[model samples]
Target: MGRYILKRVGYMFLTLLIITTITFFLMHSIPGDPLAHMAKNLPEQVKQNYYKKYGLDEPVFVQYGKFLKNIVTEGNLGESLRYPGRSVTDTVLENSKVSGRIGFQAVSIGIVIGITLGVIAALFRNKWPDYLVMFIAILGITVPTFIIAALFQYLLTVKFEILPTTGWGSFKHTILPTIALAFTPIATYARYMRSNVLEVSNQDYILTAQAKGVSQFNIVIKHILRNAILPAITILGPQIAGIFTGSFVIEKIFGIPGLGSYYITSINDRDYTMIIGTTIFYAAIFVVAQLLTDILYGIVDPRIRVSNKDQ
Candidate 1:
């Protein structure tokens, strides 16, 4: 397990290196200079001086080397062109708090509600409850999150005056956004869990348990749910990570001050430092999530341990 973890971490570092290199060159290759976007009113001579001061006048490779060196030694993400002396790392960290909070809430709600509904639906297959849950799941997958958010904003906020339309403040402000983000994941989880449960419940072991006159509830909980939930756990890593990154659109629409909103603004303003900083942050989160998922697989199945030993 320790060796596996070390190997995974090594791969994560290599992935980050590749991402950083690509982001560096791509940002540099864009048509307009970051300085030009920021200092539009400045005279050409002044702008050239600014470029030279920032080493933007240097060869791309030289600039990339300096960028990499700054990251390695100073732990700096460089200064933001949009905010002059401000460090991009600081900006992203500040905003990431909000995004992280929303993502946590949404994913928690998704997993809990989704898994419950799925389990229930599987247990009571073809019943009214199952049909109702399936219908809702279908809607979740079909509707875009933004559309649901917008509709809720208009109906719940605009007409009913029941919820806040935008901005982050109290719990009320978070409810609509969280629901919008969670609905799709809930749907996905429900469907996946339902299928897995149905399949696992029908296996020979379940029949043997039944033949042994094991209590129905215990069989469902101890046998069916444990074995069935493995796939859902595997999907959780990417799903949670995706929610954080994909929140960019939702954050913008809702006027929430989050990493997603910051990323969008940084891209629009061509803030190279912030862009790369956020990208690296996102990549790191994805790597960690994937690692966690692998660990979870071992926890869910003792067979995995036996297989590892055999190998």
Candidate 2:
């Protein structure tokens, strides 16, 4: 198990290196200078000084090398070109709190609601409850999150004045975004889990348990649920990480501070450091999440863990 984890971590670093290299050159290849905002109508000497200050005067390869070194050795992401002296690491960490919190709530809500709906639908297959679950799942999948957000803002806030339409720092404000974000995930898990449970129900063990007169609830909680939920766990791991870095659109529409806003702004301002820093940070999160997911597979299924160990 330890060896497998180390191997996965090694692969994660390799993937991150590739992503960094690709992202770095591609960003530079775009037809704009990071200092363009500073360079507009500026004197030549001042522009040159600015270039020197940010190391833009250095060759691209040299800058890339130093960029890798700073992150790998000094554990630094340097300064934010947009904020001027604010460390990229600090900026992201501070802003990520809101994003992380929202993501946690969203994913939690998604799993609980989705699993419950799915299990109910599966257990009551072809019944009214099944129809209702399927209806909700289909609706969530069809609707875009923003539309959901807008509708929530309007109905809950505009019409009834039950919830705030915008802003953060309060549970009331979190309601709209969390629901909007969680709905799709709810739909996704419901569909997948419903199918998985139906299939698992047909398994021989399930039949044996039912024939042995085990209570329906015990069979479901012990026999059916454990195996049925494995697939959801596998997919949910990376999604948990993804939801954190990817609420950019949601955050913007609702005016929440997060890495997403910084990322979009950095591109527009051509703040190269901030752009690369955030990209790398997000990539790292994604890679680690995947690694953890793989590790979790071993825990969930000892058969899988034993097979990998033998290899």
Candidate 3:
């Protein structure tokens, strides 16, 4: 298990390095200067001086080298163009709180509701409850998140005035956006869990347990749910990463101050430092999530550890 974990961590580091390199070069490759968009009023001589001061006048490779070195040694993501003297790190930290909070609530709500509905639906197959759960799950998958977000904003916020329309304030502000973001995940989890449960419940061991006069509830709790939920656990890593990334749209629609909003603003303003910094933060989260998922697999199922050793 330790060796497997080490291997996974090593792979994650390599992957992150590759992603960082690609992202850095690609962002630089885009036409027009980062300062061009910002310093429209500055004279050409002043603009050139600014470029020289920032080492932007240097060769692309040299600039990349400096950028990489700054990241490694000083942890500097460069200064923001929109807000001079402020570091990109500071901006991300300030804004990320809103997105993080919303993502957390959405994912939490999604996992609980999705898993429960899925289990109940599978357990009561062909019944009214099963049908109702299936219908909701299908709706979640079919509806786009943006549309759901818009409708919730319109109906719950604008029409009824039951919730606030925008900004992060009371819990009331979060209700609509959270539901919209969580709805798709709820649908996805329900379907995945239902399939897994249906498969596990019919396995030979399950049949044997039933034949041995095991209580129905115990069979489900001790055997079915345990095996069935394993696959769902694997999905959690990507799901978490996705929730953070997906907040871009949700934040914009709801006028929340978050990393998503910061990213969009940075891109429009051609704020290179802010863009790269946020991208790195996001990439790191994704890498860490993947590593956690692998470790969780071994912890959840001893069979995985045994299999790894044999391999």
Candidate 4:
């Protein structure tokens, strides 16, 4: 188990390195002068100084080497080209807090809603309750998040005047964006959980549990849900990117101040450091989420053996 964990950690570092390298080269490869997008025009000499200051004047490989070294040693992501004085790390930190909060709420709502609906659908398969759950899940999956966000803003804020249309503050402000951000995942997980639950229902152990006169509630919660939800972890490993993408769209629609909003602006402005920084940040998140999910598999299922011997 320790060796497997160590190996996963090593792979995480390698993945981040590749992501940083690809993002840095890709940013530099774009055909445009970074100085051209600056807030104000500068003299030729001043532009050259800006290029040199950012080490853009150096060979790409040299700059890449320095970039890795600085991040490893000093945790410096360099100053943001757009923000001028703020470091990339600071900018990401400030904005990530907002994104993280939204992502957390969105996922929490999604998991609860999806799992509950899925369980009901599975238990009453072929009945009206099952059809109702499937119908809602289908709508969630097929409808685009942007459309949902727009409709939510118009109906909830403009029509009903119950929720705010823009800005981030207070619980009321989060209601619409959170719903918009959660729809896709709720659909995806509902399908996944329902399918897994049906499959688990057919296993011999379930029959044995039933034969033993186990209460239906205990069987569903203690046995069915615990086992059925295990497969959902597989989905979560890749869902981090989905959550970020949803947050991006939802944030833009509602004017929330998250890293996703800033990350998009950084791309439009061609802020190389900010682009690379956010890309690396996302890569790190993907790697860590997958690792944690792997660890959780063992805890959730005793059948998942983790021997010390290397695979």
lDDT on C-alpha atoms for all candidate structures: 0.88, 0.87, 0.88, 0.86
Candidate no. 2 TM-score: 0.96
Sliding window of 10 residues with minimal summed lDDT for model 4: 302-311
Query: Once model 4 is optimally superposed onto the true structure by TM-score, how far is the C-alpha of residue 198 displaced, in angstroms?
Result: 0.7
lDDT of 4 at 156: 87
**Candidate 2, residues 1-311: lDDT per residue as tens digits?**
88888998899999999999998888878887778876778999988988898888888899889889998998788898777889998888888788878888999999899999999999999999999999999989898778888888889989999987778878877878888889878988998889999999999999999999999999999988889988988777667876876588899888887778888898888887888888888888888888888888889888888888797
Candidates 2 and 4, the one with greater TM-score: 2
**Residue 184 miss distance in model 3 (angstroms):** 1.3
* Poorest stretch of ten by lDDT in candidate 2: 237-246
lDDT of 2: 0.87
lDDT-sorted candidate list, best first = 1, 3, 2, 4
lDDT tens readout by residue for model 3, 1-311: 88888899899889877887898899889998888766779898998888887788899899889988898898788888678888887777777787888888998999999999999999999999899999999889898788899998999878989888998888888888899989988998999999999999889999999999999999989999889989998889888889899888888889888899889888888887788899998998888998998888888899999988876
Off by over 4 Å in 1: 43-45, 309-311
List the candidates' TM-scores in order. Answer: 0.94, 0.96, 0.94, 0.95
Q: Give the alpha carbon lDDT tens digit for every residue of 147-235 in model 4.
A: 98999899989999988889987888888888888888789888988999999998899989999999989999999999999999887
Which pairs clash (backbone N, Cα, C closer than 3 Å) in model 4?
none
lDDT of 1: 0.88
The segments of candidate 3 whose C-alpha lies over 4 angstroms from its true place after superposition are: 309-311
Error of 4 at 68 (Å): 0.6
How would you encode candidate 1's per-residue C-alpha lDDT over 80-176 as one tens digit per residue? Answer: 8788788888887888888888899999999999999999999999999999999999989999889988988899999999988898889898888
Give me the overall lDDT of model 4. 0.86
Q: Which predicted model would earn the best lDDT? A: 1
Candidate 2, superposed: residue stretches over 4 Å from native: none
The residue pairs in collision within model 1 are none
